[model samples]
Target: MNSPELQNVPLFAFATAMEFSKVFPEDSSKAESQNQLIPLSGPFQGCFACILGVGILDFSAGLASLLFNCKQTNFKISAVISLGICGAYPDRGLSLLDVVNVSSDRVGDLGCEEQDGSHTLWDKSILGGNCCQAPAVIQKMLVALPQVVGATVNCCTGTATTAVERVKNMGCDVESMEGAACFAICQKFNIPAFQIRAVSNIASTRDKSQWKIEEALEKLHKCICG
Candidate 1:
């Protein structure tokens, strides 16, 4: 079922090895623990994919390995697709199992801190706003998928006040720890990229019961497989 253009596509995931395995059961072979990249094959489409772990550190390492692999195999990567679960700002009307296509991404915490405990967002003028957008070709490919603006941060918003502030500051619909980094890296290489995420919880609360990781993962798998 692989599209001719997507034969060697690299799909990146930021979940734990176990979580990734659950979603990609066809990648049953031990991902040669020799390097940062875990080689994978799509069960549905037979496209090349990899589980890049969670957060910025793993992402950096995996991206380097992926580039190296691409060069070694004389392969031209067709697309960079990231799939995972993310927290949502409740006001966006997103539920736990809703999957979203990241239309754009921004680093949520890359700004100066203030003395009075208040915070000001980075000036988009001087800094020119470090943001990445989904490629137009990808937009057309996944136009049926729900779209949202993603804010990437090292820390998740833990309070209602902070969530509201972030929405006002970044106009983001969903938040994750890795989306912006993935987007920026793709943009650097001038690669067409897509970031798809399933909402697992509301950013304003830390309650585990309120989150739905299993349901989100299931929906994410279906969205990516289709």
Candidate 2:
């Protein structure tokens, strides 16, 4: 994905470096032997990283700044490749360390709460509509991987009830905190944006012991760098 056109190259964004640490030169054993690999530690060989922060508000604000602030800094992005870890619904055939391309993601929690314990989620009626997609090139590149729907929530779905609500309302296979925001901002900018995430935990389970973040990061690195 390297090119001389820094302004038009795809930007690889992360919520935090921890999720993408496997791509760091010092952390990636494969990086040491592959000199031709896209150097993603920082700005290198037309590849760059923008930390979208850890949550929705920060991600939205950060993404906005990434586009507008670049004008003053003279840096610009033509596309976005947002990568991170996510929680998959246990029944979705997704397990820890499994990486997949997110075909579409919607914010599952933004809506009004009714007095009768019923909630009305606005995701379906949002002006922009849900279903976000990546650029054609990325879709082609990741054609071999399983493409799944994603739900972006205020937090990880730690309870089975919460997970069921999201699945019933958003009909998503996986959950992340920032996917919808990333896609939303990219759509607003009319730039291609995509998400590829690893399953670090199961959305229907609250047991932290089942989370394998380290292994998920390892898999995520191989998917991108190898």
Candidate 3:
């Protein structure tokens, strides 16, 4: 079948579990136990739709694919975005409140071990390859945000050293849990997509006290709204 002609493209933004909780307070009446959609008005004008409760790896991937498959006004989504908080490696020069534009993503932890003890998971080339490029419209929209940085990685870097090594290896500016999955889904559907992340903490030793989650989430709201 032919792709539907959409007047306005729908933007799908995904946030982490904690950020989602803050953005959409739990409603007991809703049987799902998690808030899924947070509608916006005014400047967003309903064109921008946020998908919360997408913290789980498989769930997030499935949800994004499901949305893409759903019969909206058009067959293909105008754009898909994952806006949330991520861990930044200090060596990469990213500080809290800095936004990261994901140029690429990969399953950092999904690989098999070789006889030489080297592990290999899906790489950026395998996920979308050179053919996977960010949408021009999304890039234009991001140019207005000066603090935005760019990054790519295959797995989540939770430790300082691991974060640093991955940054050095992949040349990415930040780390998160689900961008690769989002990228994979978009690529599979031939849909245009982008990922923007606000740095909430240093990708160092586990330390919750250092995270600026609330501030990052607020910044994310503003960025997407803008």
Per-residue lDDT tens digits of candidate 1, residues 21-95?
556666646543433445565444434556676776677577767756665666666567777889989789788
TM values, all candidates: 0.80, 0.82, 0.72
Once fitted onto the true fold, the runs of candidate 1 whose alpha carbons sit more than 4 angstroms away are 1-8, 28-46, 123-141
User: 1-226, model 2: which lDDT tens digit per residue?
Assistant: 2234555666667777566456444533432221122344432454656565787888888878767665456555667787889999867777788888887888888889889877788875112222234344345556767888988889677788888877887768888888888888887877777788988888985998878988888888777766
Backbone Cα, N, C clashes tallied per candidate: 0, 0, 4
lDDT of model 3 at residue 79? 63
lDDT for residue 36 in candidate 3, whole number 0-100: 40
Whose TM-score is greatest here?
2
- Model 2 has a clash total of 0
Error of 2 at 11 (Å): 0.4
C-alpha-based local distance difference test score of model 1 = 0.68
Full candidate order by TM-score, most accurate first = 2, 1, 3
Ranking by lDDT: 2, 1, 3
| Alpha-carbon shift of residue 199 in model 3 (angstroms) | 0.2
